[model samples]
Target: MRENLTSVSSLNMAFTDSMKPTDLSADKKGIKRKNWRRRIGFLLKTNSSQPILRLVKNRSYRPSVDDVNQWAQSLDKLLGHKYGKAAFHIFLKSEFCEENIEFWTACEDFKKLTSRKDLVSKANSIHEEFIRSEAAKEINLDFHTKNAIVQSLHAPTPTSFLAAQKKVYSLMENNSYPRFINSDLYKELCAAAKGEGKHIKS
Candidate 1:
């Protein structure tokens, strides 16, 4: 994998054998391949080189995770190897993943876009930070934990608190609780307007 990437990098863009950009780049987040020719480079029917590395082919620009998936699928058709499929997915997690919303929408995209279980926990942490940040637009957590907090605020009973704890447990089932509540969780709690239901004087 390293050799092919390096070899492709060393090849001049004008080289007769170098791949034409049909529609991909390592940085592009939302673009798809068919419309990519106008944006990046030409997609070709044949790999720019042969035998230097038979395992993979890439584009002039750094190929994005989406492109890698397509290329890997192409190779899968040619080689009939399951490893080829596995490697492509692993590459997607590494290449497309980001610590901030600027790169990825949420940590969930990392999993939805790729099939790497090894990445879920780490990605979940980063996603938790992103959720807590002011810039975040989406919130992700289990519904149970969220409702427990809401119900506790509305009807403060020991039973409710236990239910809330159980809900929190549900959200944090596999991992430790985060240091801070996410913006989405906060908003949900605030939206309940528990105290607004009645007026009280200090």
Candidate 2:
């Protein structure tokens, strides 16, 4: 498993090496200049190929008892915790609906853009990747919402995808969240968190 992750990491590096934008720089969050493309691509490849093995391999982001307890409280709480979100993303992948979280995550990052150029470029990218019909990882969006985003791309803003993001969030909250709460992956995480030291919050 470790060997697989290392190979995936290497492949991602090779895939992204020639594609880095010259104008890009690390963000305040210390995210490297590879930005979303590298991550999105790596996630799609890794999740689709090795859902279970990837989870067993990556143990650096161990969850705390409070993290697991908070995750059970709400979808937002779960996403707010880094490890919880990562776990849920894996669960979504295993169910073959990871695009919902992928699109949601892209929008969250999109909202943090301060550069007008970046806002425009990323809005169009998001539209192409997740909004357009037959998009590679398209989410289930209504025509009205999808058209609205298309119309706004020429003058995109930080909130360009706000409506669409909310819709996806609602979809995941209603559908995936319930399943995740009862999933073995989530239960295992809860158990692991408990084993860390303190009793899990009931």
Candidate 3:
């Protein structure tokens, strides 16, 4: 009976030893899964927080226009208003031609740079990303404008992208601006603004 009992104890010890590696492996896998979940959660949290960042960085202030008629009166007037710029940007994005406005805005900022170092650096980056062949955000340009920009690259100035920028601006003014003025989004904004004005007057 003693020998039988000893044999049972030995079997139990062997079983426990065999389970150790499997149990450890399962624990490791569980930890890995938890870490993966945590990483995904972190990414989701970061992505969700971006809108809050935009809110903080971009002022909530909308240009107050007493009359919505001003927007329809002139494209220049519409382009000058903050709401108009935002609406136009959205429209450009919808059309997949956002690079036109983006390039134009970049040129505006580029012209404001005081440092030659910054000018050179920004010019190279902009040219590569938006003007070079098969660029990620290449803007449509005539051959003359393209050639001018390529020549300017040899000695980049604040106005290195001026020709290209002008072309993009013209494109927006002639093409996108007309569409934006007629878009449902613009109509909605106009309606909302008019409603706000009426509410205030009352």
Candidate 4:
């Protein structure tokens, strides 16, 4: 059985390799052949890994307003992933309060940097744009948090934005988050997800 399975896998690999395009010509025939090869290769790869890929693809499912609401019921669920952040951003944009989400997202991304140069550069950028007074898209932060960020800027580290980021997070949790849960947009999304008419409102 093991030998048979190995032989089948080798055959599948050989078939996939045979479909790869060899010619790089600019003519229609060459282009068509290349496209055909790519399509076949894609189909074979997807077919081979369908079970695992299905679960990964499902993670990317776009949530409706009701889905968002259910997620919002848990703070960790709402703030844990980019999907939640993106949904909140859309809602904030509609409400003209997008800066909060923007600042929060920037902080999240900033923490993921590995290079010292990038950390310093992004920290300064975040401070100038969101934490600095009279700056465009300035985030609402208390003096203590702003002062700590300023101090961190003098000797910027990966955690330089921690204080400010926390403040923005708390602001969203206490303020915009609740409003988003109850907004007309959330209701519409929930209704749409349920296959109801788009005009339905909560």
lDDT of each: 0.29, 0.68, 0.57, 0.58
RMSD of every candidate to native, in Å, equals 22.3, 12.9, 21.3, 15.7
Lowest summed lDDT across 10 adjacent residues in model 1 is found at 33-42
Error of 3 at 112 (Å): 0.8
Runs in model 3 deviating more than 4 A are 1-68, 196-202
Greater lDDT among 2 and 3 belongs to 2
- TM-score for all models, in order of appearance: 0.19, 0.69, 0.63, 0.62
In model 4, the runs with Cα more than 4 Å from the true position are 1-61, 64-66, 197-202
Report how far residue 114 has shifted in candidate 1, in Å.
Answer: 16
Candidate 3 lDDT over 1-202, as tens digits, reads 1112112233122111111232334465454333222322221222332321132232333333453467677766766665455456555644557677778878888989877788788888888888888998898887788888888765778877877777777777788888877865455456545543222110
> Distance from true position, residue 197, model 1, in Å?
63
In the range 6-81, model 1's lDDT, one tens digit per residue, is 2234222212221224334674333322112211111221234531123354532222334333332343231233
Off by over 4 Å in 2: 1-61, 196-202
> Residue 21 CA error for candidate 3 (Å)?
52
Q: By TM-score, how accurate is candidate 3?
A: 0.63
lDDT of 1: 0.29
Q: TM-score winner among the candidates?
A: 2
TM-score of 1: 0.19
Residue 188 alpha-carbon offset, candidate 2, angstroms = 0.7
Cα displacement (angstroms), candidate 1, residue 86, comes to 16
Rank candidates, TM-score, best first: 2, 3, 4, 1
